[model samples]
Target: MASPALTPTTPATRDVVLVPPAIAMVWTGAGRPHEIVAVPGVVLGAGETLVAIELATVCGSDVHTVEGHRAAPAPLVLGHEYVGRVIEVADGVRAVDGAHVQVGDRVVWSIMASCRECDRCRRGLPQKCRAVLKYGHERIQTHWELTGGFATHAHLRAGTAIVRVGESLRAEVLAPAACGGATAWAALARADEVADVDGATVLILGAGLIGLSACAMATDRGATVVVADPDPARRALAVRFGAAQVADPRDVRALTAALAATGSPEYDIVLEASGSPRAVQAALEVVGVGGVVVLVGSVFPTEPLPVDPERLVRGLITIRGVHNYAPRDLDAAVRYLRDRGAARPFEELVSARYPLAQIDQALAAASAGRAVRVGVDPRDAHRRC
Candidate 1:
């Protein structure tokens, strides 16, 4: 004899599952393999909400975390560059209600949550917020903070600075704005002090996301932008982005001579977006007296850059190191993209998109320079759906 199905009036015996669906990439140990795991029905915390991730980009930083080079714990959820829709909001979180955020509203949030009362936050530099914690940090325990955008759902805290994207912008296009685009905005803010973009000559090193963005902004600011990169394709892209000139770093001497013929030491500002030490050295060589050199890229296993002290002193050079972006920077990037006509045709920086199940392939494509931006669609059928 079989038991009858429980009716509304009868007592239930089955466990009430509480876990929410999440697609998480987990590393077992150092040099060990990683696996994507699915958790069903994870709980959302008070003053928090669950976001159904629409698109999550694989940033260079994400590669560092996955390779265990960042000293982060294993079996972690990866990804910080993302945009999504709010599915559930905790009680008392009123701002997100009906602002088109029910089940399917376009949105994006910052990577770190800063305590607004902190000294750094008070000073208008929330990136330096002392009490802040990143998404993948080992300290957070709750599913909301632990499982980041690489999953089906991301837990957003009460203080999370969320930006609502317009319906016109494509999720795949706006995804990079969360990190790569924001970083470029921060760099430009610092560069403006010395670059005097209205009429100044500027030299930009590398043609990656940051470099291309700088070129675009500088051109918009009326500066003559010169870009250098070894890759021909990137060099061509830089030219398309409005760079006044593009050259290969290997032919620095010839490029410098040609520029000098037009007018030597023409650059009033040198922006180094390449982490290579050689590029830094070349940047210092090309900048004029009283020029500014902004270091915007990160170099791993920090080593002493071979810089000429005498030249730096004699040239009255100003060297500034730029880190991650602040909230204001993100706002600026969004505004720039919005105002510049979101439909502007540009190269498809995203070369590929892999489902969360194929994270290994995605990571490899990102790290090998095969793709400028690789994305993971966490809600794909093969993911922990």
Candidate 2:
């Protein structure tokens, strides 16, 4: 006969029993992720903690993985954007800031963990460390099988910075701070820590989470902002987020003027977050000479465009690519959400919240581009505590 069942109390305190592996949406190399009933019960490893995920948001990169456009570790859990409360921690465990991350503290962790001894990390580029481990993108063979956020409980690995979020922010508002918001913040960091944005004309190529977040940050820096997106709803939302001007991407006038600098002063900065190859090519074309072009969208293989080598050389364009952000970027993201979340319609970006059982439905809406971000509660289907 099976042993007596383990029942944990509310919020899953440290002394709570080890519940069975909560449900997790496993991605197994397909156009959609498969909802697998994960084997429950996660034991805390040394310097590691078990976090009961309170909220998780679907990211565009996760969508790419589901669509097979981006290759990820198969048989892996697919979400990394999440906010949760620490329920259990191993002995000697503490956050990067040296504070003991106690149970019940609202938290968000950086997506990628790096070894400080790595050359890239030593030089301050941990995001690209030779042996970086990114949660939600790792294989099941990693330290913990339940490392991703598409589960009821996530294993917070060592070296992962646990940034304490302000208690006033809602779950949806704080969910993307580590991934989407952090990526946006890090990309814009190339602009002299946003100090140069004051009085500068900034044009963003997408109105998704990253783009809109960048718009808010840019406005905070006193930049004149214009945003472009084909979706009317997104354009409206962008305007609400502090864009001075909004334009449809298909507009001939907007496209022509974006990079030519012929009819108007070319934008001082061009941010490509549309995840579209066409947008990237257009960005290269639209910026004026000496302008900076920052690419944040994780656009994978697509039809390539020919480049005018001499034209590129003459423009003196500074094109930079940013992936999972550095630690400082995550700090900025938390601060941004904490300060401006109340005023901005951060939750508006989430069209609807869906239970994990209906994850396929959520993924459908996300793929259709109807929702900018979709919230998933693993406990929605099966509550563990």
Candidate 3:
């Protein structure tokens, strides 16, 4: 006879089943604190999977929602950057590599779950599908209350691109790959499509998680990278991540001098991840003729940036904006982290950690701008920081 199927009560399954009353932190609005409450166990749908969140990092976009910088559905679960272990897999589910998803597998999923038949999906931009269901941005519903990483359990819905990660990878090193790392990969991929990244002169504005990841990726590809950020700590961190030179974005002279020292006086590729309007303007100005500028930030509302039509015509510059990320980008991100994470200071990118119940402190640490990324330990949901 065939072996019996493993039950939820199995010792191995203990990793996914919380002690009792699975809890989640609910973000009510901009100025209010999160509410800790028990959430029901997930009832997986067809092609869905249930994962117990191992570690979740507070992303800048999460801070934006909490601070009212961006508009999102009220009372949502506000986290997207995380890594988890699979608890249960529904029928007909496969990973990005076309392998069947199994229980007890460590995984990271795409930020946005898209309907494959949508126009954007058909056009090769599934990240922007009309029926996209963003994990952290969705409203709470009875059927899908555990949609975000701030919770102990996330119900991975159908069409969500899941990639199985290695069991050996540290949670902190893998969490940011969901958003910051993947988006940066998407931006660089765009630049590579326009101009080869190898031996390219690249300028990355913003030394935060995305910026620092881009810096490391560019340098890994043989590019001479210059990173600009207002934070001294982040700049120092960027150097460790493989930036050939670092500068203060606020100081135009320092930026200009760095570019001149690069021997080109202009960047072949400029990646803007700071979300600063001035930085966006600066990216356009410093990019060389036939250069490509990939804007990976600026998700929030900002003042209109004035652009000169004559400059675009004369410089032959290309400007592209990358939001969330494509599935292929997420695939590349996981592989990159799995392969190069040990060589670079990728683990240093997550500077702080807090238990899920101490989410307020976690968000505080994240918003304080001192940490590249702050993590939340969902397994310690009831513990102190």
What lDDT does each candidate get?
0.70, 0.76, 0.85
Worst 10 residues of 3 by lDDT: 1-10
Q: Which numbered prediction scores highest in TM-score against the true structure?
A: 3
What is the model-wide C-alpha lDDT for candidate 3? Answer: 0.85
lDDT at residue 2 of model 2 (Cα atoms)? 12
TM-score, prediction 2: 0.89
Q: What is the lDDT of residue 273 in candidate 2?
A: 91
Residue pairs of candidate 1 with colliding backbone atoms:
19-40, 19-41, 19-42, 20-40, 20-41, 20-42, 21-41
Residue 24 of model 3: what lDDT? 83
* Tens-digit lDDT track of model 3 for 1-385: 1111211121222123445656789999988989986774655666678888999999998988888888988778889999999988876789999999999989999987777776788898988877778889988776567879998888787788899997878999899999999998999999999989999999999998899999988899899999999989888888899988899988777888988887765789999999999999989888889999999888888989999978888999999988888888999989988888788988877889888988888998999988889999988775531
What is the number of residue pairs that collide in model 1?
7
Give one clash count per candidate, in the order shown: 7, 6, 0
Summarize candidate 2's per-residue lDDT along 1-385 as a digit string, tens digits: 1111111111322332445556677777776447575645654544567788888988888777888778876888878899998888866666655778888878889897665566787898977766676889987652356768888878766557788885788888888887889988888887544336676788888999999999998888887788889999899999889988888776647755543442347777888898688788877877767778888884577777687778768888777887778888888888888877677888788777887766677777788888889998876646532
What is the descending TM-score order? Answer: 3, 2, 1
Ranking by lDDT: 3, 2, 1
